[model samples]
Target chain A: MAYQRKRICRFCEAGVQYIDYRDEKRVSRFLTERGKIIPRRVSGTCAKHQRMLSSAIKRARILSLLPFVSDNPA
Target chain B: MSELRNYEVTFIAEPNFDDERVNSLVGKYTEFIEKNGGTVEKVERMGKKRLAYAIEKRQYGYYIYTEVKMPGEAVAPLKRWFALSEDVFRHLAVRMTDRDVRLKAVTTEHYRKEMDRRNAATRPGAREGGFREGGREFREGGRPERRDD
Candidate 1:
């Protein structure tokens, strides 16, 4: 098997206890260019943190803090 | 008296309002929360910014966040009031409880320690591993490609 780089969960590493929906900048990093939430595998977020992140993203989207979908021309 | 609990509400306001009117709007909501038997802890005005998408044909929105302490039962009525309001576009109220507060403080710590233990038991440099969806290699077209011409 090819030697894959170790990918630690950034939130885990940074000790992110709670995912706040108001910080759009921090939330934006977890989203793709198309405004989709990056999965756990790609984002390297722990299961718990991933769950928290997804909910926060959804909540932010509802409050218009984040986009449901991107406006860019695909 | 009903036991007071914590809640954090965020609302989106119309961007067309002047600063004075916006301040008034915030004041009105704060008063509403107070009248609902809640003590407003802090009100954060996030200011106007471009919405990720247009809401009601407007490309921008104003945001205000309020943290308050009130009885759990009072939340529904306040939310209902927000829904009926004309100026507010969207609002979200998250009830904070003691259990949630404790969990937020400890989940990260426990998660970190668990990760450490798991990593220690693995191969010299094996990662804890992650899930990857090996989805379909070929794309399926909903409509026949090129109408099969």
Candidate 2:
């Protein structure tokens, strides 16, 4: 059987407007323990949003809203 | 010429500014990098999110990330720029080796999956009464419910 392809951007759901990095609860979902932004291919985020998401994650790290590295074990 | 290194610099802007102003500020940084003979690999705009803690009494901020390939000396000028910008609340510059770049790509994949798992766990009905072991509940009012049970 052929595999089904999934839509790239999950946040395309109507009414989802912006990526917020300060919300570790929300941003943590997009970052690895080492503090890297998960890519679109793996996160299924569309290219545009993934780019946005990565930027947000990076900002959060600098502000100490998120850690540069994960302290908790995965 | 000294070897070029990959560096990721991220910064948070005060949440109250209009989007246009934020973009302009970010553009300034891009321009600075280009003027310094650095190649900007990417620029990302992460939207507003709540701060982990209050910053200058503000609860949230706008975030921006930029990746650049430049000589090690460029970091000093970049740091100076960040220090001078009132809009920037915090910033960091991390040098990346070839190994670090490769590992970052792989780790990013793992991060995505982990996020998916958390999202799945949060969907309505994923758990009874929206509570999970060791997890706090966030009420619709935006306050977290303490797990007293």
Candidate 3:
């Protein structure tokens, strides 16, 4: 197997215990250009933080703080 | 019966509402919470802001968040009020769990530190616009290739 560097969870490194849905700017970083949630493997988020991040994204979408689907799929 | 628990209620009201109207609506909701065996701990008007997408054809909304302590029964009625009211376009009520309280403190501190770091690192012209920061990839899609048949 080829050697690969292990990726660390951004939230864990930052000591982020809670992912606030109101912080759309930060949450958007984990979304794709089409506004879909990036998979845990790709984002390098641990399972626990990934769960919290997904729920937070959903809540933000409900509040229209983040788009459900991007109009400009860049 | 479930004991009184703390909940954070957030709602988006019509952006066109005047300051007086907004204040009255806040008063009305606080009164309703009190009547339904809830105590209003705090009410914050987040003010008019743009929505990520149009809701009911409105591009902007006035956000109001309230922290309330109430019995479980009060949540249903509050939801019903939001659904029936024309003034409110959207609403969310979340019961604050023990973990949530702890996370709140942790996240707040982290956020403050993150902000300080960001401010220190940021320079003029570092960010061009709001659009690019959200997505990592940018591709030019101005024209599509056409094949003649």
Candidate 4:
């Protein structure tokens, strides 16, 4: 039987940039109810972008474009 | 005299604070910048969003962005302030040179264009059934082959 290997993530292979914290729209997608970015496993982001994404997300949180938590419970 | 440089500082605040409390924290940092001879060009409030992972066990946080022009020496004091503030969860201070400013503008423009394209593609009655098939596949199977070159 021929071996089938799992594919790597393109964002990891091609080095597609992850969203920066300053880029509000991009970071918004990954956030959870409390306005936090979901982890790599959930977000499916590559490691490098994940690092940068986290930093940016943290920055955005500090700046307040995103809420600390959803004002209205979902 | 030291050359004036633009700096962008972004930080995360504790989640669940009212607007007033969040603003007060932002104000404190802005004041620190001004007191140290830094000119604040912009102060943006990026509301709450989910963390990529749990941070201090919090699932979300408020975000703030500040653009200032100041001497290099002022950064240390600002860092110290951030360290002492419990409300601030994380912070970063980056010096923005002329090249950086230009690059930023270009990137912002590019992002804007991309956003427009995506929006148009998603509009109702437009290109029905042309949804990005690869994204779903990649999300489910962690496959790279479906990504565009």
DockQ of each: 0.29, 0.13, 0.58, 0.14
Report the first chain's TM-score for all candidates. 0.88, 0.73, 0.89, 0.66
The best candidate by DockQ is: 3
Point out the worst 10-residue segment of candidate 4 chain B by lDDT: B137-146
State the displacement of the C-alpha of residue B112, model 3, in Å, after optimal TM-score superposition.
1.9
Can you give the TM-score per candidate against the true fold?
Answer: 0.73, 0.53, 0.81, 0.58
Q: Please give the ranking of all candidate structures by TM-score, highest first, separated by commas.
A: 3, 1, 4, 2
Clashes of each: 0, 4, 0, 38
DockQ, prediction 1: 0.29
Clashing pairs for predicted structure model 1, backbone only: none
lDDT of 4 at B14: 86
lDDT of 2 at A5: 75
Question: How accurate locally is residue B67 in candidate 4, as Cα lDDT from 0 to 100?
Answer: 86
Give the per-residue lDDT of model 2 (tens digit) for B76-110.
Answer: 98899888988897777767678756755665565
lDDT of 4 by residue, B20-117 (tens): 99878877887888899888899888778676446779888787778889999888998999989999887778877787677567766766765664
Estimate the TM-score for candidate 2: 0.53
Model 2 pairs whose backbones collide = A19-B47, A20-B48, A33-A70, A56-B46
Q: After TM-score superposition, what is the CA distance of residue B84 in candidate 3 from its true location, in Å? A: 1.3
**Which whole-number lDDT from 0 to 100 does residue B54 have in model 4?**
62
